[model samples]
Target: MRAVLLFAVFVALLAATAVFAYYGLAGPEEVALGVHGWTAMIIGVIFSILVGVGLMGLMFFSSRHGYDEPPQVRKDR
Candidate 1:
C-alpha cells in the first residue's frame, strides 16, 4: 500500500514537471537546448516513469533476495 501511494505521488509529480517543461514555464530559450516544448515534456514524463519503475523493480528484487543487510555483527565478549 505504501509503495503504491509513493508510486502514485511520484507519477503525479513527474506529470506536473512534464507539463511545466512543455509549456515553456521556464522560458522559450530552453527549447533550443534539446527537445521542443511538448516533445520535451512527453519525453521527460516517459523517462521518469521508466526510470522510476525500473528502480522500484530493482529495489523489490534486492529485498526479495535479501540483499539488504546490516553490517554490524552481534557478539558476546
Candidate 2:
C-alpha cells in the first residue's frame, strides 16, 4: 500500500513537471549558439572535475582505511 501510494505520487509529479518544462522552454526567443555551447562546455567540465575529485577521494580513503586489502584466510575450518 505504501509503495502503491508512492508510485501514484511519483506519476502525478512527473506529469506536473512535464507540463512545467514544456511551457518553460516553449518560448519563441532564440537562444544564441555561443551561449549554448559555453553553457554545455562549462557544465561538462565541472561534472568531469567533480567526478575525478570524488574518485580520487574514494581511492585515497579506501587505501588509508585498508579497504583495498584482501581479507584474512580462515584455516580453522
Candidate 3:
C-alpha cells in the first residue's frame, strides 16, 4: 500500500514536470543559436563525454587491478 502511494506520487510529479517543461519551452519568446553558440555547445558536449569516458575507464582499471578490494591487516608483521 505504501509503495503504491509512493509510486502514484512519483508518477504525478513526473507528469507535472512534463507539463511544466512543455509550457516553459513553448513560451512566446523565440531564441536562436548562432554559429558560435553551436560551436561552444558542441565543444561542451564533447568535453563532457570525454570526461565521463575517462572516469569510467579509470573505475574499470582500478576494479580489475584489485584497487577496489578491502585492505587486509598484516598479522604476521
Candidate 4:
C-alpha cells in the first residue's frame, strides 16, 4: 500500500540520518558532540519538524476551507 511504502521510506531516511550523524559527529578528528550539543540538535530538529508540519496542516486547512480557491467575478445590474 501507499502508506506502507511511505512508512518504509521514512524509516530508511531516519536510519540514514542516524548513521550519518554518528559518523559526522565522531569524525576521524575524534570530535564529539557534548550533551549540550545533542540537546540543541534534538530541540532544533523537533522545532523544524513542528514548523514544517504546522505549515502543511495550515495549507491543507486553508484549502479545505476554500481559502485557496480562485476569485469570483461579480456583475452589477
Candidate 5:
C-alpha cells in the first residue's frame, strides 16, 4: 500500500513536470541562452542532471542516518 501510494505520487509529479515542460515553463527563457530551441533543450538537460545528482545525494545522506541500525541492534538478540 505504501509502495502504491509512493508510485502514485511519483506518477503525479511526472505528469506535472511533463505539463510544465510542454508549456515551456521548464525551458530556458533568458537572453543569454540565445532564445532558441537547442538552448532550451540544453537547459532542460542540465537542469535534469543537476536535480538528479542532488536527489541522489539527498538519498545517500538520508539512508545513512535513517536506515542505519542502532548500536544496541547490532548486538546478538
Candidate 6:
C-alpha cells in the first residue's frame, strides 16, 4: 500500500540523517559529548516544568473565577 511505502521512505531518510550526523560529529578519537546531552536534558526539564505550571495556573484560575459558566445570550426586537 501507499502508506507502507511512505513509512519505509520516511524511516530510511531518518536513518540516513542519523548516520550522517553521527559521522559528521565523530572525531578521530570518537569522544562522547556529555555536556550536550546534559544540556539538552536540563533545558527539556525546565521547559516542561514551565508548561505544566502554566497549564495548572490556567485550570486553577478557570475554576476559581467561574470560567465554566455559559455566556448570556441577548435578543433584540
The whole-model lDDT of each prediction reads: 0.86, 0.91, 0.93, 0.93, 0.82, 0.90
The CA lDDT at 62 in model 4 is 100
TM-score of candidate 1 against the unseen true structure: 0.47
Ranking by TM-score: 3, 4, 2, 6, 1, 5
Per residue, candidate 3 scores C-alpha lDDT tens digits across 1-77 of: 99999999999999999999888867655665678988999999999999999999999999999999999899997
| Ranking 4 against 6 by lDDT, winner | 4
Residue 16 lDDT, candidate 5, scale 0-100: 94
lDDT of 3 at 66: 100
For each candidate, give its TM-score against the true structure.
0.47, 0.56, 0.67, 0.62, 0.41, 0.48
- Measured by TM-score, how close is model 2 to the native structure? 0.56
Give per-candidate clash totals. 0, 0, 0, 0, 0, 0
Model 5 clash pairs? none
Top TM-score model: 3
Candidate 4 stretches greater than 4 Å from native: 1-26
Model 4 lDDT tens row, 6-41: 999999999999999988867777566779989999
Error of 6 at 68 (Å): 2.7
Best candidate, lDDT-wise? Answer: 4
- Model 6 clash pairs are none
Any runs in candidate 5 off by more than 4 Å, and if so which?
A: 1-35, 67-77
lDDT of 2 by residue, 1-77 (tens): 99999999999999999999887767455753477898998999999999999999999999999999999999999
Which residue window of length 10 is worst by lDDT in model 5? 26-35
Cα RMSD, each candidate = 9.2, 7.6, 2.4, 5.9, 9.0, 5.5
Q: What is the C-alpha lDDT profile of model 6 across 13-34, one tens digit per residue?
A: 9999999988877845556658
Error of 6 at 26 (Å): 21
lDDT of 1 at 2: 100
Say which prediction, candidate 1 or candidate 2, comes out ahead on lDDT: 2
Candidate 4: worst 10 consecutive residues by lDDT? 25-34
C-alpha RMSD in Å of predicted model 5 compared with the true structure: 9.0
- lDDT value, candidate 6, whole model: 0.90
